[model samples]
Target: MKALIVYGTRYASTTEIAAEIGKVLKENGFEVDIKDSRQKDIDVEPYDLIITGSGIKIGSWTKETLKFLEKNKEKLSHKKIALFAVCGATRDDEKQYQEAQEKYLDNIQEKYLTKPPVAMGLFGGVIDPNAKYGIMDKLIMKMVKKDLENKGIDTTKPYDLRDWDEIRSWAMELASK
Candidate 1:
């Protein structure tokens, strides 16, 4: 089987996650191709399975991911599809995590990718001050970090909340199906 994994990332964390997913898929005996959504166009019709993901920014997906879904909705609907989202809300609270999942995944599914995916994943994201950010973004993150800390969540240092084991397990499960 052939699988294609495409992702939209800002600070490169989502790209790393997509790469890991592709690696596990390959290990499970599927031929896999991975691409950044910002790259040149490629047809999705050749792949037997399609997986797409994005890092959430203000409860919205990257424009590239949205465009890809919109442009290929028909072809994707005919293939086995899986979707994932990366966001920092999972690091805070259960209610926040659920809300993020609904806003980032469920709503996106309902609005753009109308075809149901075989599986969907909600993964925690990283927060790094060193990463490139505009003045407003940096200011916002500072406040966010302070708020998290006040809530008894340690945000004094960079946070990488991804669960590698869970990611690999999910990829393996997708391969099996």
Candidate 2:
């Protein structure tokens, strides 16, 4: 089987998650190709399964990801698609997780897809202090961290909230589908 993993990342956390998914798919006997939407374009015709994902920012998926989807919507309609998204907001609460799924994953499916994905995952994301964040962006991140801390979330310096086990489980399930 052939699988294509395509995604957009803002600060590289989403990139890492996409890579992990690719690894799992490869282990399941797939010939996998991973593409970063910002740097490259792909012809989805050769792949049996295509997994697409994006990082969320300000309640939106990365623009490049949306563009890629829009560009290939016609061809993608014939393939098996599995969707996933990475976002910081999904980590803090159960309610927030569902909301994140609805906003980042479901809303996207509704807007761009004619058919529902065979699998969907809404996963936690990272906030790396080492990334090239601008002044305003830094301020916003700091404020968000402070708010979480104030709520007794024990915010760390560089928040690494990704749930690896859950991520792996999701990929394994996608392999079956």
Candidate 3:
């Protein structure tokens, strides 16, 4: 099978996740192509399977990803789609994880796309203070950091919440279908 993995990310973490997904798909004997949404326009027609993901920012999926979905809705409707979301909310609490799924994944499925993903994942994200950010992002991160501190969560270090084993498991499951 041929698969296309497309991702949208602000700090590159989601892109890394996409690469890992590609690697796992390749290992499973599938032909795969991975693309960064910011760098290129994608045509889903050539692939039998499509996996698209995005990092959440201020309760929004990246604009590029949304546009790609909107533009390619017809093509995607005929293919098998698996969607994943990356956000720090999953690292907080069960309630937050539920909210993140509702906001980031469910909403997109219900309102944005013409086709529903056969499999969906809501995964943890990364937070790195040292990463470059624009003034607005910096301000938002300051507020986020303050909130974490208030909850007794340390903001002094970067947080990586991606679970590679879980990611690979998800990919393997998808590949078997």
Candidate 4:
């Protein structure tokens, strides 16, 4: 089957995860197309399955991914589709992480509840405090860092909490059906 993997990333962490998913899908004998959500236009009709993802920033999913879904809602409803989100907060609290996923899914579902996507997945994201950030993200990260420090949390180690095996298994299951 043919699949399209589309994503948006601010720090490039989500893009990495999306690419990994594409790789695993290809290894499982699926023809996969990986595209950045910033594309001016997209043709969803060409693919049998569509998987879209984006990085979460400040408790919100990227705008590009949301726009893509809204733009192709009708076409997506007719195809096998899935959604994923990548965020650093996902690693700290499983319940909160899941709530974030549900929030995004709810937004999409509210728009297309009559015809929802086939499935959805949530994945952990990478965090690099030293990475260049805009004024707002910088300030936010600084506060987060302070809070973590007050709680005696280590901030030096960069963590990539994504589960490649889980991603592979989900893609394989979708492709098999």
Using TM-score as the measure, which candidate wins? 1
Clashing residue pairs found in predicted model 1: none
TM per prediction? 0.93, 0.93, 0.92, 0.88
Q: Which 10 consecutive positions of candidate 2 have the poorest summed lDDT?
A: 151-160
Candidate 4's residue-wise lDDT over 1-177, tens digit each?
Answer: 899998988888888788888888898899999999998798889999888888888877778888988888777878888877777655468787767767766665666434666767777777776677899999998887777678676778655667888777866776676
- Scanning candidate 1 in windows of ten residues, the lowest lDDT window is 148-157
TM-score of 3: 0.92
Q: Which tens-of-lDDT digit does each residue in 7-80 have in candidate 1?
A: 99988889999999999999989999999999878689889999999998877889999999999988887899
Cand. 2 TM to true fold: 0.93
lDDT of 4 at 14: 82
lDDT of 1 at 44: 96
Candidate 2, superposed: residue stretches over 4 Å from native: 129-132, 152-156
- lDDT of model 4 at position 24: 80
Alpha-carbon local distance difference test for all models: 0.88, 0.87, 0.86, 0.79
Better of 2 and 3 by lDDT: 2
Question: What tens-digit string does per-residue lDDT give for candidate 3 at 19-41?
Answer: 88899999999999998887666
Please give, for residues 154-174, the per-residue lDDT of candidate 2 as tens digits. 555667789999999999999
The local distance difference test score of model 3 is: 0.86
Runs with alpha carbons beyond 4 Å of true place in candidate 4: 112-114, 150-153
**Model 3 steric clash pairs:** none
